[model samples]
Target chain A: MYVAVKGGERAIENAHRLLAHARRGDQSVPEVTLDQISEQLGLAVDRVMSEGSLYDRELAALAIKQARGDLIEAIFLVRAFRATLPRFGASEPVDTGAMRVQRRVSSTFKDIPGGQILGPTFDYTHRLLDPTLAEGFVPEAPATAEASTAATPRVTDILGRDGLIEPSPQAEAGASVGDLTREPLNFPADRDLRLQNLARGDEGFLLAMGYSTQRGYGRNHPFAGEIRFGEVEVEFAAEDVGFAVPLGAIELTECQMVNQFKGSATEAPSFTRGYGLAFGQSERKTMSMALVDRALRARELGEEALAPAQDEEFVMSHSDNVQATGFVEHLKLPHYVDFQSELGLLRKLRQEFAEANEAEPMKEAAE
Target chain B: MAVLAHAEAGEIAARLRSLALPDHQDLREPENGLVMLRGRIGGDGAPFNLGEATVSRAAVRLASGEVGFGYTLGRGREKARLIALCDALVQSRDFGAAVERDVIAPLREQLLARRRKVAAETAATKVDFYTMVRGEG
Candidate 1:
């Protein structure tokens, strides 16, 4: 039970004004434009776009500027803005197999097809803080190679061809796909819903959970099957258009994990796979998602659900940072009436205890 | 269609204006919206809803009774309208060739050029490794 006490109208108004003022600190310096944020602080925008589940780079940049670089707040802003728009329809599932792959690497095999292109990675860089970067420097142009016209088949596909890996579960024909945004998540959710939940789950939370899996908590002997960052065409089958048209291309990072699978009675002795896909060049997030995804598959694989990462209900419920922040941040709201009731109860209990202690002293004297 | 979705709004507007196209009415007003993107589970597996992307679409009708629809992947209101206008023109007998030559061909070139530049840059980063084996060295 609760009562509403409202009297912060002016204070709330003034606080907003103060926030606006603070956002535009040192007005003498040229204000940062959305283009600058979009181009320069691009990774921040990507993170917000991924977590917000909205793929508008410009809007994400605007949110970042409004939130003053607070990414979670920026994600919240993007989510709020996205709700105002009507949905057109779901796109044709993007064909990553035909992606114009920019960066592709396979840890499982050194000599895989398309020969391991290390496109614009920080993996080889020494962790040195360079002062020259602050001053701005342009590195020399890189030497060129002809991009292989040969299609880069997925590492998983190669393994699948030889029956070395468990086959991907076939999708049911004529079954409607699940959309969490349109419906509340019911427990024992199917893989489709689970994948969707994990797709938008917080990077940090998933990262920790993923790391836990590798540290022997629900370990699956994971290997990076392949990580690819590239542009893939988005096809939309608009009814009015009368055919599927090329909507546009969007950058996506895909991670496939090959995990060791011991054969169950009904299953074959073959390697298993976990998958992750994200909106932009977000390899780190995708990798983390893949690890947690495998961990969450413990039940289906007949593995013991002994770790936090393996607990699907616990993991999925707490995965959303937006929901977590809202419930946690609501503590700052006025709870004076509730607190007063608790305070009154505590005082009464103390009084009763003191009276009981007094009676105990008298009883001891009588004894 | 790909060029229309991928081209710059400013370029699309400039191209459309140069043609002195016939007046058009909006069948559907240019409106921004969302499209939920999807992905297959293993790139060859079950479909799952990935995320929503910002989109703007418009429908236009020409005087010649041909209806045109335009859908672009981002929030470009004017771009969607211009694309709609072009779509309608392309369907009409009189203006189809003229609109293609004046508007779409150039825009397609622009899209191709943009893609090529990025492709070249990305291709330059592709690596080639040579192994050194030590056998009783």
Candidate 2:
């Protein structure tokens, strides 16, 4: 009865074998290819890439397949792999203004320049599932337009020209950007570091934080001034050529939120801004990021930090799902030795207490 | 360059093979391997492992000693070899223009057409929202 649970290696080995068998399921059915997952289960791949902070679709698809389609597990797998990679030279900050925008919309204005292009969204679609799609379905292609070189003027630019909104950060050429990978996060982080943390933070966690802010916690009158999804060219400095060369283009989602700032006693009323950018078509993630980003800026804005989201230390420290999952799942591991020591101490304390009670009764009888 | 990045390595290889370039040797044999993709929180935040990606890389040298390297996203040995050959040809003084004109130019047009097709399809479903100025009047 007291025998300790031993020989876990064999069990573990067998369990792995069973897992492999289960992963393959039926022998007759064709195995799911990485391309199939990358293209067909594209949204899942996007989520893994977004959360995993990696953009390589093939790798994300592979991770998804290995993790049995578990997004978080796939993210963990990706994160582990990412830890081992070497860093290449950083590219120049992408120009979102020049983005070949596929979907650009604004809730703040009824209409704006380049007009609202709701490229592809499920915002107005019914949630009903079509059972017929189980057989097969192919989406019809859409109409196209010739690519325009004209830059899309930001909505904020209109207000900025009049000095109505707070002045945006001036682009400082060759400014030293902090690398989160190389440095441990220190609290009271600068805007750059905080935004970085939020970008890679768990989507669900950020969504909840964002939701809390909207429910009057750190209430800000956020108007999604603009949300855009499209491809932007990444450029790297070509030292030999004396100018940056366009390395490639990657899809990105950018959101700019404008909030009405009712001026405090010392400051004048003006519009404030919160920005979010993420890999791929991550509208919800990007939008939620914008809200949280704004909420976290309470201290900078001279506003009271009265909300959970406003506490930068709290938000950044526990935002990572991998860290959270590890700490939680660690409880399942063997703690028998630690438990046994506690049991021994409890027994000794009980024995001493019993003897003291017996001695007190004898002394009372003698007296 | 963007076309190469987005295009499948196998497709690139097929195109390169069809070019029928002069004899070349593998400077570095096409090696199928994995590259770990790293990520950062918020972009500038602390780094975390995103995952490993399968990749194939090769380097080729033309008879004239012009060397070229090719790195592709997945395990496509033939694709890698072809890309490497194209890379070498691109560096060759005599063949560079021809390669760019025949290969890259066509690839770019094809990629653009594909993108336009998708954009057109998506535009068909575009929705416009409007609001009424209520009361005050």
Candidate 3:
């Protein structure tokens, strides 16, 4: 008794029109501008930029508007737009040591060099909504202090100096880094590729995986050695110029997690490093990224890869929201023809079953 | 020769754009687009996408058959085309000196002045920390 619905094209056209109206929402009311989203909903834009793998604040804001504030949808839009752009050249790696840090903190030490600057964080804020903000009342600004220009060294370096942490291996100069977008991810991905994937991976997925690690699935005892947010200058080499030239700066959030590693037969026990860096003030994402990154390094550290978080293939393949959403949402497309065939087979089997049951009773009576 | 910084090149291009450039054939018309910015941890470790930035680029061939290219951040199509023209003109022995004197020098001065102003502003925010030894075990 299934009736195939028609007018799909007409319905879709009308749906889009309705969506446009919904996006505007109450024509009498003032519309939200791109600047409003970019300035006020900045964290949302940051997350979209971080996960979307795009950085234009204007584009991120527009995408947010177009997606009706569905962050994942905005991220999908950015990712799709990113596919059309041409690649120039990769910039030289940014110098985090020389970063003009706006915020720098460490959980490992009581007081570290450059001191703990808790710049513009919601860490201590109570979960209370202020009604005055809705009434458009601006609050008094916090007291400003003279900015310190001291070099904020990495907290891991302090542990490294004492031979307490496992020495990090250095990448060779002029070594080519892999681009996950351009190439398919292969098994046993190196640290570079793993980090690249995690940087643009879905924040929620990474957060859950990171939570699993902390909840004793992967069980890497980690200390937030350093979480720093700031701007760093981008430099690229021009062909005519034999040396690197500085481009304008971009904002960044970097996290270095120091995790405990027990002694193996060949080496002594020491702390290991798990690093994460993203486009903006993505504090939660950076922290989660650090944890998940550490969990993924279980195999590299010669530890047992027993948990789902430790399984590189599983985590990497399913972490991209764009791919996940597309495949999952594809089910909503027309399945009428395929399902109808299945319905016909089901009916035939049922009729045959009824006929066989009827014949069995007769045969029994006859016997 | 000291290589010009990206900002410096950008500034020169901007100045050149305001003044306009000699007539040239559009080898590649100015197109505004986006480019993904990538970064790394600790300057040498794992790589990550920093963000996307707006960029415009164009190419031109001068009447003298010298080809030039220009690129700049943000949607400045005329700026990009002007830069391409300047680049081509710089390649010409006849026009290189005049372009450098008229365009590049003024931009460099402006850029340097801006840098000095920024440094002064930063200096105003400097803080000096003082420490004293306390009795300890």
* Highest-scoring model, lDDT: 1
The per-model DockQ list reads 0.75, 0.24, 0.24
DockQ of 3: 0.24
Q: Provide the RMSD of all predictions against the true structure, rounded to 1 decimal.
A: 1.6, 4.7, 5.2
Model 1 chain A: worst 10 consecutive residues (lDDT sum): A141-150
Model 1 docking category = medium
On DockQ, the candidate that comes out on top is: 1
In order of lDDT, best first, we have 1, 3, 2
lDDT of 2 by residue, A1-367 (tens): 1335687898899999999898888989999999999878877887787778666788889999998887888989988876665433455566777777888888987567667778778787798998878877766654655444445667777667787677665435664555465689887887767766777788899899988999998998889988988877655443423555444566778788899775767667779887777777888988898899899999988899989989999999988888889889977878788778889999999999999999999999999
Error of 1 at A174 (Å): 1.2
Tens-place lDDT digits, model 3, residues B1-137? 11122344456655556544566798988886765566665334555545566666677898879987766555567666666777788898878887788776766676567545543444343234356668743
What would the per-residue lDDT of candidate 3 be over residues A1-367, giving only the tens digit for each residue? 3356687788899999999999999999999999999999999999998898876777889999999999999999989987787766666677887777767788888578887777667887897997778876886745455455577788877777887887655667776677787789999887777888888999999999999999999999989999988777766553433445444566789998999865788777788878888887998898898898889988877789999899999999999999999989978877888888999999999999999999999999999
TM-scores of chain A, one for each prediction? 0.97, 0.90, 0.94
* Clash pairs detected, candidate 1: none
- Against the reference, the lDDT scores of all candidates come to 0.88, 0.73, 0.77
On TM-score, the candidate that comes out on top is 1
